[model samples]
Target chain A: MSLSEFELIQRYFAEASTDASVALGIGDDCAVLSVPTGQQLAVSIDSLVQGTHFLEGTPADLLASRLFGSALSDLAAMGATPAWLTLALTLPEPDEDWLQLFSSRLAQLCNEYHVSLVGGDTTKGPLTLSAQVHGFLPRDHRLTRAGAKVGDLICVSGCLGDSRGGLDGLLNGFENHTEAGYLLERFYAPTPRIELGKILLGKANSCIDISDGLLSDLSHILKASGGLGARLQLEAVPISSQLIATFGEESARQWALTGGEDFELCFTLPPNYLALLSQLPVPVAVIGKVTDRADIELFLRGEPCQIQGSGYDHFQRKDD
Target chain B: MSLSEFELIQRYFAEASTDASVALGIGDDCAVLSVPTGQQLAVSIDSLVQGTHFLEGTPADLLASRLFGSALSDLAAMGATPAWLTLALTLPEPDEDWLQLFSSRLAQLCNEYHVSLVGGDTTKGPLTLSAQVHGFLPRDHRLTRAGAKVGDLICVSGCLGDSRGGLDGLLNGFENHTEAGYLLERFYAPTPRIELGKILLGKANSCIDISDGLLSDLSHILKASGGLGARLQLEAVPISSQLIATFGEESARQWALTGGEDFELCFTLPPNYLALLSQLPVPVAVIGKVTDRADIELFLRGEPCQIQGSGYDHFQRKDD
Candidate 1:
């Protein structure tokens, strides 16, 4: 039997939300949520299209995981606790089997992240998924990109460029080596650094998730912080062993600098707070320092070097 | 100059939010909002596709108003005070003039409704607009569809079926008569009955926005309230003079009973609380009463009547 929109929601996503914060979940014109007295809400939205963001044949569970993790990373950048989620899922048609796996993975993530799947709308259109995540932080407390000072030390969590490498391998059809498999996993399921965000709440001067690569996202911090700039010690940039083995050190380093979809957190901290890095849940790399210069400068082995691509632009034609 | 995603946001949507509740607005990883103490958050999301929701040549400002007004109606149904909005705007390409008109109208609506344009994502894809609206209500105080009791008086705010008439006129290319123009306006910009929603709070037993026509939306209330049904007095159903003139009384009545996208409120009230109807901001019609039966029964001049095409379902094929 063909499923109507109501039946589709009832069968696949009815029980996807079971968080205490959701006073009313699904089936309503609006989902009602209870906010704690002392907490503020942090909300972010991300959209993933079939051809623009991923291949058409991508697995349903993996797509759900990728979209959820990347969206939640925005809250992680704000040092906020994940609380609620709303989705607007547009599909070309009602694919029951695809929806089953997608919603199962979504529910699992909601459980893992302790977020309530409060509401969603299912519509018929070209395949596009928009996920809005709402997180909470104590009143008047948050990490913003505008707090980086000229002397602050720039830092990043985890090795960058693995997701980009994974995308590259997927496009080129790499052999099923262990390294290739690791990169594929990175592309499919990124870990939102929520716990690390919590640890850096008070100490980090500024923070942002590395979604459009370290260079692009870090430049946002610089631009937001009164046009302050940064100098990166390219030698200190971290690269995973698997990524290096698959794509060579030179390409891996370039991807670390300019590749996108790395959901790791990049932040700035004062020199006095450097000791706090030792207590972080993930490995920390101090690769650069904020500068007064107004533009990013790169130096490798004591010599300046130029990068090829600045970052991803959804509108501007890449070649131009 | 061709605009990148960042440039487009900075140029068009940077100043869209100025509400005090927004601690941080556009240009942040997550927009931080200060939810007032003793208030719960109410959220809803709606998506409008290019071919599915509207025609290709629809004016940008009209499209913006339609999407925003319709999305906000969900909060209105819950008796929540509208507050913040996030848009996931997927466009085929960035047309500067179109963006100007669209964003200008969106900013105007934000001002008119006291809603902050907190944050949004712009991407290159098929033209699909998804809007997620946030609102605030008193803690533990909300109108749910499950609250209706059998024998309650059924009430509807404003005239219904005008939007459907408007849509039909548009699709059929009606002459530019005054009635046709009114119906077109109704189709392009249906008002959200937020004030009436506030008036219904604490008095109405249950309430919902009539988006998917009377039968379909009321059926939701019935199912939510444990299968209690309703009986409609067809003569008492309100239809606009414009709709009746544009489309004969018979078709208008049918549309009033079963047409969708009206964006009006439908609620149930106890007989003792019937006097509250006089205090509503909009005209309301008492066209029905709750019943113990599990299916809607309609009466026309004391005789049984039947209606066709229950309502719009996104996934269900119309032929089925």
Candidate 2:
């Protein structure tokens, strides 16, 4: 059965979801919206295409959840509250089951975060999904990746490398109720640290959500602040015991150092917020300290461990 | 040569073409902007692909001009002035010549319309361009396709069907500076009637930009505004004699009824505004009148001629 673009939109995406801020929604040529007073709107768009970003036969629910979760995490980095989002779906053919599961999960996630679906575009083409999320941050209190100073504590909420490990485990057709499997779940349904981000609004001087691993995203803060360096204690870095038990210490270390898509908040704070961070809902690990000299050093008990690549660079060749 | 996505963006994009409204532009996670007071921001977006919208070997300058013109025409439909635009380009590979030509032409068009480059995304992928344009309209006045009344005079701005003739000539490879060539130029570089949209704000009760030919786009206005029918005088419509000489009356009539990229304004107004509209900068043709039936009737020498199809309906096969 073949579907034209118009019929495809009506069947899969014609339901224009409602949000308070959307003065006018889909069905119109363009969306009309208003930014709340004393707040600035922050928008980020992420596009995921079949084969390009995800494996074939990936669950619709997981794809919906993780893609949006990763994108919303960008707003979390800037201390922005989720508002509304528009989805652009280009699919090879209309799949009713896929649309049903994807929309159900997306709608549920939006409800959980107090976010709303405002608009979307559906067309016939290769399977691609582009989600544009709009959020708002306070006028005077926005977090940026450009304010980390020397001696600031480099803190990250939540564990790392589970998503990559989970992918490996899933690809290997291995599953267990053990801690390793739990780490794999963390990879599949990585949580966006929205609460931790808002909590650090006044306290965190600089922040970024750890999407592309700890060291790489943290380096963004360092590079932006200029001439800044960081000293990371390998022992202080938190790793899930499941990751340690299954992958062993060395592989887990590799995961911890270079694991991508963790979606944790890596932030910097002055000494004054140290005690406050200890009382937070999520785990806050002080893995490093900002330095004056421009060299990011990793120490395992005062001995320099060899540092190579951490996290995935989009431009880096896999074979290389 | 296969290129990484990040390298593609940095090389072709990341230029940050500067203009006044771009306080903070591309390279950031989100674009920060300021909306001026006393004007409502008008926004619209359009996506064009190589085969989907235009020919593969079309001139890069002409492609840029047509793509931006299509989006800017939406602002004209809403009676708004052009302000800022963002382009998301997805390309198969790096083409230095294409980039240089496309960018220069796009820049010239942006400057001519007084639109500033704000933000965009560039990725290595298929050859596709998606552009979102924004502008400012008077706070209270927005020309919409839903305000026509029963007794209003149906007026259209500029000559129609030139684009269709041009397209026909292009397909046939008939190259001479004939009337059809001029019409095709109109199709390629549609002069968005921004000033005319503004001038017809309150005077024209209902309005739409005629990209999809007259009878079809006007049908949209009628459907939205709860209209019955339209009585169009075939001879009253403004048509270039060049079109009449080249395509003859029948094909010229076909062009006027089905040309799908003219970007002219089709609007309805009370007869009282005839005196006022006559004083405007451009020509206005009072070609039709609203009727009481739910059927459109065309009269040539008081003889009925039925138009079976709407302008380029997505579901129907186009003649071209």
Candidate 3:
């Protein structure tokens, strides 16, 4: 256990300050920030646990990136430009290397997005992290998950579920040159689609990032819009070629449909804005459409099929 | 320990409706918010741990209120209007009654402040809570701790050390109500001085909320404003008359000097605004003045006395 909380914060949580927009950073009671004028701020918070969120010996930098990426996914969903973040970390003990890796990666992410580390809390307990992020959205341009019309096209950025496949490999020590390992890396270091989010602010109707499986996460958009459901085209759901080569079709399908932690944007757009959506800096592929049916479903070549068991139900489970 | 993470959030966290200004509330990857035009947002986060910050078996509603008040004090210090908040709660199990009490008090706080509970995380683990709050500030006036200048009058709202006295009574179970019991209640249900904060926003040059002991927290103002110190009148440090009567002058004085957890506002006003400060709504008593000496001193009838230790240092004796 850490000897003291103050030392723990200094050692494990304080990131190197370079171009931090924070008027006052951590070490104070609260972090103070100056937001740019004419911009509305988007805010989100997420917590990740050790045994549950990651494997026992996961790389610290990778874990840091993945957690931040998960929270950043919310900004992307809102089409908000990244701004600043605060962290609350509870740990079992102080580890020097872990702190170094975590801080370095945090600094890297902050620099990449021009965001700053504003404030945080560090405590000694079970290892867990909760991050609260702030971002800027233009007036009347904040993307939401509630505006998807029935005819709007459903789109997803990047492939989904390779992170789960990677975890399977990590647990079973399965190795494949195909995309599972690559997808795992993708899962671990998802590049937050900041630019794409900015472009879709007003262009997209309803938006969400797929951290859970597609059906589970996309259901949020459907429910938010007061829409009945969406019909996801299984074949059209993007899967990395590497994932296909390694996990094979059946396993890849399982991962894509049910496995989660991809941190990809799963959003809806008006059909008329297809050109605009296609022109986004990141690849955005339409794979489904909102429908009047209340029952969310998956269609494989126009035939109804079960959606890999509600796509990661916390109350339900698959026996490995 | 718990069944699943989603169930935890759904059961303990998911509100039927944020039903407030939450453009998009919980259940999405991130919560989307709308910032009213022309108003800047103030943000702060604080995490509390069991056995470190509070004793086990603390009243659930009191815990929730205390934690919320801690964050509110930050907003109060910033002279910001309350807006939205997110909570990250980790626990060993789902105690139904505890959740009921906690959520109830949380709802009360939200409704009282006109703030919405936007997003949060609930997980099974050792007990910890991180509350992140966002508030709005007026265009060019943010009362920062760094704005105090020479000849500024230092002032505080509400009495000090009551909470510390209360916590001591609770922890050691010193049931004699002669005075400690009131102190304990004061600590448990601290008033965040929101009204006082707004009243002083324009009149005060520098400001901070005293969560740590007054002497230590006030030092933040001094340090922020170039290490300019002040001489505080021992008599002027507010203490409840009942406390002095019950515990006698010596113990109450000790508590006033080094005990903490009082979420009161401490601010500085230039002499030019001194008359204006005196006319403010709350009793904003000028207890001291900024001085050239770089070390804080306490005066009891013109006799200089040593303050034994830093206020609220958890690991060391305050008088050591």
Candidate 4:
């Protein structure tokens, strides 16, 4: 028997609520939530189409995790505490095994992040997934891309390029390589640094998630921060050892610079707060410094170098 | 020139902030909002994919209005005041004229409903429009499907079957009929009864939006209210003159019972609350009474009649 949309939601998505703030969850027209007093509600939305965002044969569980992580990364950039999520899932056909795996991983992530699945629509169509994540933070403490200032130190949490390396491996049939497993995992299950976001709330002047590569995402920060630029130290950029082992240093470095979907938080900190870096739980590297000029510059081994192309442009032709 | 995602958003979506509650709007990882004190937040998401929820050639303005109305209807059912919305719009290709019309109508609706467009994503893919609406209401006064009692009077706001008639006209190429215009309007631009939802908050025992026909949607209220049933007075069901004129009385009546997407509010109220109906701004028909039995019964001309089908099921075969 073909699975009905209602049945799919009931069997796979609906679960007993443990969240006190979620007055109503799935099965309601709208989920009712209690926003804490004196806190600002932060909301972001992202949609991933099958071919554009993921390969057709991507594991359902990995897709679920990646979608969730990507959406939650926005909250992390905003320094918001994860609270509630709504998913709009469109599928061409109902597959019971796929739904089971997707929902289980989704539920697990929700639990880990303390976000309740509120309400959403499930329809039969092309494979597409859209997630709206809501979080909360004090009004004055929330981080934004508009707050960067000249002389502020630009930093990034954790290694980059691993996800892009994984994508390259997947597309080029390099899965058999020993180091490809870790790279693939990074691509499929990139973590949202929610804790780090909260920690950087008052400290970071500007913040953004590295989804469209470090250059592209950081350009957003620069643009939003009112004509600021950056002088990036090439060697200071963090690239995973697995990425280097699989694809070599030069290619891995290129991926770190221009390949997107890292899901790492890039933030700007004032010079005075540099001393507090030792206290953070995660390894953060100051790879660059915000500059007064409006043109981004790169330095390799203390010598200037010209970057060939900008990061991923959604509308750019593949051959361009 | 092809439209880039950033350009698309900047040209059509990003607008000057007029809502004070929206601390941050577009051009950010997350939109920050201030929820009112002593109020609970309500959230709902809906996605309309091409060929499934709408015809491919539907007017962009009409599609925008319909999608917004449908999503806002959920908030109306929850007795929440519309506050913020985020739209994730995926398109196969960019059309300037279509986007202009769509964004203008969407902006107009947002202004009319006092909602702020927050943050969303636009990507290249199959046409899919997903909207997430957030609203707020006092915790104790919100409506839910599970609140109805056995003796509650069942009522619905506005006329029914018009949207279905409109849909039929569109699908069957009978849109040239004089009355078809009105029916088509009903289908393409159904008004979300936000005002009525707020007014019914304390008076109504339970409530829901009539999306999947009166019978199917009301059944949800009954099922959620714990095995309750309803005795619907068929002759009392409100059918629009446009629908009856275009599709005849019997077809119109049948559509009223089983045609979906009316976007009207259906609610259950206690016996004494009937007097308050006179004060409501919109005409509400008391079509039935909630019953203890677990089977919905229909009465036409004071005689029981069997209903052939419930409503549109997403997974059901077309010939079923």
Return the top candidate by DockQ: 1
Q: Tell me, per candidate, how large a share of the native contacts it keeps.
A: 0.80, 0.10, 0.43, 0.81
Chain A of model 1, TM-score against the native? 0.95
TM-score of candidate 2 against the unseen true structure = 0.85
TM-score of B-chain for each predicted structure, in order: 0.95, 0.90, 0.90, 0.95
Taking the tens digit of each residue's C-alpha lDDT, what string does model 3 give over B234-272? 888888786676566787788887777788888988788
Candidate 1's docking class is: medium
Instruction: Tell me each candidate's i-RMS in Å.
Output: 3.5, 4.8, 4.0, 3.5
What does candidate 2's lDDT look like per residue over A46-112, in tens digits?
6665554567788888888877887788778877788776665655556777777887787678878
Candidate 3 residues lying further than 4 Å off, grouped into runs, are A1-38, A56-59, A93-97, A175-183, A273-278, A301-303, A313-320, B1-27, B94-96, B178-181, B245-248, B271-286, B314-320
Q: Tell me the lDDT of model 1 at A118.
A: 73
Instruction: Please rank every candidate by lDDT, starting with the best.
Output: 1, 4, 3, 2
Task: Give the clashing residue pairs of candidate 4, or none.
Answer: none
lDDT of 2 at A252: 74
After superposition on all C-alphas, the RMSD of every candidate to the true structure, in Å, is 2.4, 4.3, 4.2, 2.4
Docking class of 2: acceptable
TM-score, chain A, per candidate? Answer: 0.95, 0.91, 0.90, 0.95
Clashes of 1: 0
- Is candidate 2 or 4 superior in lDDT? 4
